[model samples]
Target: MNDRGNASARLIAPLATLATVLLSIAGAAPLRAQGGAPPFDVPAWAFPTAPPPRPGTVPVVPDSVTRHTVPNSTRHYTRKQVGNAFDIPDWFPRQHPPMPAPVQYGVRPEGRACGFCHLPDGQGRPENGTLAGLPVEYTVRQLRAMREGTRGSANPAASPNPMIAVARGFSDDEVRIAARYYARLQLTRRNIVREVAQVPTTRVAGLLYALDGTGREPIDGRLLEVPESIERHDLRDPWVRYTTYVPTGSLTRGRRLATQGPAGPTTSCGACHGPQLLGTGDVPPIAGRAPSNILRQLINFRTRARRDSTAASMYPVVDSLTIHDMVALAAYVGSLPPSRTPRK
Candidate 1:
C-alpha cells in the first residue's frame, strides 16, 4: 500500500491541471441533456424506462404480464414460484434470482423483485449496477447506507431511488442472503464501448436513450449507451446486451487518466483497485461496468451523496474531475474485460 500510494502521487499534478481546465470549459452541469432541454446537473440517465412497443405490437407491461412462456417441466408451477426471482426459469438460466419468493417477485405491500431492476444475473443496466462478484460485506454495508439515507441517487428527479425504500424494507437475513448470492457469481464483460463524433439520433425514452432517427447527430460531447435489443430489454430478457457511444478520443484520454493521472488530485486506479482494477479486498471492481453507471458513481462521490467510510476516501479523488474527465474515465474502465475469478 505504501508503494502504491507513492506511485499514484507521481501522476496527480498533471491530471489535476487537465481536469481543472476541462471543468472550466464544461461548466458545472452533467455531460448530457434530454431532448432540447438544458443540461441537468444530475445523473438522471441511470434509470431504465419501459421501452416503447415494436412498430405495431402492443406494449407489454413488465410486472403485469409474461411475454415468454415457462418450460414444460415447470409449467405447473404457481405464479408464486414462477414470478419469484429466486424461483427462476431454468431454461439455460445463466444466473438465478437469489432472494426468496416474495423478495424476488415482490409483495404488493413492499414492491418489485430485487432482480427486476438489477436482473437475475446480477449484471444490471447502466441505471443500476453490476452486483456480481461484489464483496458480501461491501454489499451489506451499501444496503445499510441506502437505508440510512447516507447514499442515494444524485439526480433530484431520480431522488428517493426505490432502492432506499427497498433497503429500508428488507430484513437483515434477507440482505445477507441476497448479498451472498450475488457475491458468489463470476463477473462477466457485457457492453462494448466506442467513441464516435456522431451517433444515431436518439430520444430520451424511459430511463435510457433510444435511437430516434436514421439521420446522424453529433454526440456533442455527450455519452449515449443503449441496448441492442430494445424489445428484449423491455421484456426483461436477461440475455440482452448493450453498446456505449461516447465522444471520439474519449477512451484514449480516459486510459491516460485511469492508468496514470495527469496531476492535480487523482491517482492511477490500480493504486487502490488492485493492479488489474478488478478490486482489492473491500473495494469493488470497476472494470467492464457500464460507463453511465461508472460516471454516476464518480459524480455521486464528488457530490458526497454516497457517504460512507469507503466513499469518504473517494471524495477527494473525484473532486478535480470535469464532466469530460468523468466521461473519459468511465469509458476506459467500462471498456476493460471483467475479472472472471470467483470470489473466495
Candidate 2:
C-alpha cells in the first residue's frame, strides 16, 4: 500500500512540472514571434536617454539655422532699403516693368486681384465697400483718389486710412482692371424700406409722408426716410451708372449742385472734379456711390472730421448743403448707374 501511494505522488509531481513548463512555453511563443523585443523597446544607446532634456534648457540649434546667413552675404535689398538707395521711379516714362496679370475672382477677372478680400462675389462686408456691378470708371477714379489722397473719409482724426492704404498699393492700370471686374458682376438689389423710426428727429426735414407698416416712411423733398427694408436681392438695377449704385436723377441733381450751385453756393462741381463730375486726372468720381456712404462723408466734411489737401476745394460746395440738400445729393449720386471705360 505504501509503495502504491508513493508511486502516485511521484507521477502527479512530474505531470504538474510538465504543465508548468508547457504554460511557460505558450506564454513565451508570442515574445519569440515578436522578435524578442520589449513591449516598448528602448534602443540600447537611448535607454538612459539624457534625463528628458532638463526642464527649460536651451534646445540644441539645428545645423539648418545657418542657411539664413546666405541672404546676409548676398545683401539683398528690402523694399524700404531699396527705395532709400535708388531714385524714385519715373511717373510717366517706362520706369517700371509692366504689372503682372491680375488674380481672378470666380467668373470675374479682378484687374487688381479684388479676391484678396471681396472674394468671388462682390458682396463684401461692412469693412470694405461692395463692388459688384459698380461702374468701372467710377471705381478707377475712387482708387485714384484713395491713392493720391484726394478722395477719402472726411474724418482727419482717424489715424490709419484703410482705403488710402489699399489704394496706395495699386497702380493706375491695376485700379482699372479691378474696377472692370466688379462692374461686370450682377448687382445685388436691396429692397430698402426707409426706416422713419431710426431717422434722427434733428435730421428729419419735412412731415412724414406714407409710413409703410414695415416702419419705412418717405419724407418730403426727395429725402429718403430710414428704416427701409433693405432686403438683399440678387437682381441688379439696370439704370445704374459706372461702378456706382446711384440713380441718374440723383446724379443730375448732384451735378447741378456740384457745378451750378443750387440754392446758395457759387462754384460748380466741374470746377474741381471734371465735367460730368467724372473727376479730373487726380480727383475721384462722385457721380455714383452709396448714398449712405456719401452722406456720412459729407457730414464728416461738415464736422471737420476728415481732412485732405482737396478739402478746401469742397469746403464751399459742402458748406452749402442743407440737411435736405445733403440727402438729395447723396440719393442722386447713389442712383446713377456705374460707368466703365470702353474696352479698346
In TM-score terms, which candidate is top? Answer: 1
How much is 14 displaced in model 1, in angstroms? Answer: 27
lDDT against the true structure, per candidate, is: 0.64, 0.39
* Candidate 2 TM-score over all chains jointly: 0.38
* Tens-digit lDDT track of model 2 for 185-250: 543432132313232221211111112234322222333322221111101111221222222245
Put down candidate 1 lDDT per residue, 138-201, tens digits, no spaces: 9889988877656754553444566766777676677777778788776677789988998887
Q: What is the lDDT of residue 68 in candidate 1?
A: 55
How do the predictions measure up, each by TM-score? Answer: 0.74, 0.38
Q: Where is model 1 poorest over a 10-residue stretch in terms of lDDT?
A: 1-10
Candidate 2: RMSD to truth? 33.0
- Candidate 1's C-alpha lDDT? 0.64
Q: List candidate 2 segments past 4 Å from native.
A: 1-256, 262-266, 340-344
Query: What lDDT score is found at residue 311 in candidate 2?
Result: 47
Worst 10 residues of 2 by lDDT: 41-50
